[model samples]
Target chain A: MQIRDILSFSMHAATANRGRTLLMLLAMAIGVSSVVVLISLGDSARIYVIDQFSSLGTNLLIVLPGRSETTGGPPPLLGETPRDLTLEDAISLTRARTVRRIAPIIAGSAPVSVHNLEREMLVLGSTSEIFDIRHLDLSQGNFLPPGDPTRAEAICVIGLTGKKELFGNQPAIGRWLRIGDRRFRVIGILASPEVSLGEDLGDMVIIPVAAAQSLFNASSLFRILVEATSPEGMEQTRQSILETIRARHEGEDDITVITQDAILATFDRIFKALTLSVAGIAAISLVVAGIMIMNVMLVAISNRKTEIGLLKALGASKGQIMQLFLTESTILSSIGAAIGLVLALLGIRLAAFLFPQFPLYIAPWSPAIALAVALITGIIFGILPARRAASLEPALSLARR
Target chain B: MIHLQHIERIFLVGDEEVHALSDVSMTASDGEYIAIMGPSGSGKSSLLNIIGLLDRPDNGSYELDGIKVSELDEQQQAEIRRHKIGFVFQFFHLVPRLTAFDNIALPLMLSGIKQEERQVRVTAALAAFGLSNRAGHRPDQLSGGQRQRVAIARATIMQPSVILADEPTGNLDRSSGIEVAEILEELNRQGITLIMVTHDPDLGRRARRQILMVDGRIEHDK
Candidate 1:
């Protein structure tokens, strides 16, 4: 049969049982759309994470005080007594040839009260170089300048959340807030960083490292932030830094080196597996839809037996009869597939709007796969009915009313 | 021309072999109108089916246009049926879903005739059968005579060499049956062989040659 004839025949068949055909198409659409949305969300999450890490400067490396033996756990408390990375280690790493920038961080939790507003917040103390290494954007005044180290300078930069919590619509740049027992002037306000995959890292405060060290009166250091020249040089730079730190600490394997890309890759694998599992579950509905198509086609053949016999008697060969029925079923599935594709696209768009962090990307391969799946479903389910129609005895069928 | 030499058709029903057609032999020349008349189980329909290539005989040599058809494979037989045979049935089995025009165009389509040629021939056939006004009407929309006319139009659309009508007017009234019979005879007059199966003696006697079948055997030939 010609392509036009097949298409028209299929349309007629599908329209003949509109409700059932529509339900089958909806099932197929849900299957395809869910897969697309899940995979897209996973992809978006990875992209968000990579962008977050990249903005932190390619040269930067974070050194937490004590490494946790297990992966993915909360960091050990500062007062719980782990071997704290100190100013001596930071100074030695800074003086090393491979290290371009080194900043010692002293972090603590403190309640900041400005007028009637009070909220507990994480506070980090670091040198001016920390701003460049962490790629912090200043919304207001300047960072702490290099000056006398002995005198405690009460100057700080507040994050967007910290500023909002303390000032509440009031200007926060040049304001004063109490950190622990000491009062500090906010020299600058950090611009709110964009949330990446729903993770907001801009919820803290920064002050001069020396001033914080004296105010806390606790130690030489808490954590050290180091920045290498290039990511490619990371391995060698890490080796040199580790060797130098170990040599200073009398040969100890106490530090861990982790890259953002490796963590992102692990997340990607997990989400991809999740998406496939969800899609597999949804695929069951497609099989059910296929069975429905088969049942309907069989009924159509039975209803049209005399017509088929008439055609056969009027010179339609067995193959031609078979093609006609097969074409009918294929028409049903092709329309279903087309409808499914449109629904999937709409579903992805709706999901993307509902959850900004959840990206729903529909790859071109998805529609191609849907079409192929529909075609195969049509043929596989269509075979039994087509065969039944072809096997009808022309004489007997003609005898039927 | 058509020839059947010593044709025998047997049916196996639950370990009992019933002869649907015994040693039957007949010849039908081009442009001849013939009818086979018989009661129920008399093998009249079975003989027509064999002649129409709708069934194969258990033992026989059947030839159409001097080509031995009984020995041909299923596909070969189907090819001959497609190109050489047409059938009009007792029920006027037009597809309910198709319009009268499309029903008549079906055979032309199966023969792979181009759409333009099919349209021309189908239009002519529809007009010839006085169905031009009902071309777009489905079988249910047409009367019994009109449906029979559509059936005849479909059967002859391909211009096959032989037209087989098995009780073509069985479901129609007397006047409608006469109209259908005249259409078949006109096609036969145009040099196409026409073989019909009927139990009505009046209809049987209208044929130029008549064969009477009884108990799977030809009782008389005239």
Candidate 2:
């Protein structure tokens, strides 16, 4: 038979039973859409995290007390306590020429009250250097005054949400708020939210490191932020900070210092595998859809026995009969794949609308791979039924009603 | 010409071997109108199937138009059937999903005829069969006579040299049955060999010649 003839004939056969054909189409469509949507989900998650990480800062370094996973070997001395990441250690790191600026951090949740309107939120302590190294956006008043790193100032900066809660459109720069047990004047209100690792900048407080240490009643710094003089000096500054810390902490390197790219690479690798796995899981549904097609085809063959036998009696070769059946499934899957692609796009569009900050879009190869898989699956699963139909003896098949 | 020699067909029905045809040999020349008459289980269907090349003879050699078609492979036999033979079954085996026009065009499509030629030929067949008005109706919508007419139209659309009709009028009323019989005779008059299988005495009397089968063997040829 001509190719077009076979295709149209198969299309007619497929549409003969509307309910059955629609069920098979829906099965195939669900399988395809799930694969595309799940893969997009994983990929978008990976991209969002990478975007947030890259937006952190340029030539940035984070130092935490004690050994973190993937950083160094076990502590050199057994049964000996490692020293804390202290303010003095942060001050001493500035002695290196490759170091551009430093922000000593001491973070803890504490309630700050202004005229009895108070709620507990994250309180961050740092210096004026944090304003640039952390890419902080300030909407009002200046950040912390740059002064001696050891001086404890009675001043603080509130985030946008915190500012609203405590001041309510009232002047806040000169108001005094109580943090822990100390009274500190509101120095500035931080800007709207920025990508700051895991914390929401819109709902936190910022203060000087000494004031935070005095409020928390602790000498240990939560972490330290070090900015290199230039991109090329990143490694040099890292080495200098390490050497200086080891010399000060009795020649024992017990701190964890990490770069932005290292964490980003780790996250990228994890999400790539995750995306592939979810897509793999979704492909199983395609296999199931193919099986459903096979079952439906089997039923169709049984119902159309006389029709098949008549074709044989009319001199249709086995190969031609097989072509007709396969053509039907191919058309089915092609339509299903096209429908699924439109659905995935609409789903992604909805996601993009819901979360505008996250870049959610279709990957170029996903639809191509999905479509190829669906077509091949339809054909492969069609083989058994088509072969059965072709192998039927014309005499016996025609005997059926 | 159609020729069969020493044709035998065996069936395993519940592990008891029954010979549907045993050593059946026959021949009919071009444009011959022959009917095989027999009681139930008398092997008329088996003989028709072998003659149509729809079944393989367990032991025999059959020739058509001077070619040993029994020795041909399945594909080669199908090729011969496509261009030289046509079939009209008792049930009118028109595909239920297709309209009468599409059903008539089936054989032409199988032979890969161009669309314009197929359309023209099918249109001519519809008009000749007096079914132009029913061309768009599916088999279910067609009456017994109309369906049989569509089947005959489909069988002849390939313009084959021979027509095999198996109880072609068995499903129609008396008037429609005579109508179908007249149509088959008309095709036979046009020099297409017509071989029919029928047990009805009245229907069998209309044939130019008759063969009687008994117990898987030809009992008489007259």
C-alpha TM-score for every candidate? 0.87, 0.89
Query: Proportion of native contacts found in each model?
Result: 0.49, 0.71
- Candidate DockQ values, in order, are 0.55, 0.71
Candidate 1 structure quality by residue, lDDT tens digits, A1-401: 56666566556655666676676566555555554555455555555555665776666666665555545556546544445566667777767666788777888877877866778887788888787887778887888776543345888888888787778788877778988778899898777655634434466778888778877786657777788877776677778777777776655546665554455567667766765676666667678878887887787788788878777777677887788888888877777778777777787788778977644467646677778878898899989999999989887787778
Q: Which residue window of length 10 is worst by lDDT in model 2 chain B?
A: B76-85
A166 in model 2: Cα distance from truth in Å? 2.7
Model 2 agreement with the true structure over B11-63: per-residue lDDT tens digits: 99998999999999999999999999999899999899898888999998999
Candidate 2 DockQ vs. native: 0.71
Please state the i-RMS of candidate 1: 1.8
Please, what are the lDDT tens digits per residue for candidate 2 over residues A244-359? 99998998878888877678889999999999999999999999999999999999898888888888889999999999998888888878888888898999999899999778
In candidate 2, how many Å is residue A133 off? 2.4
Distance (Å) between predicted and true CA of B135, model 2? 2.6
Each model's lDDT: 0.78, 0.90
Clashing pairs in 1: none
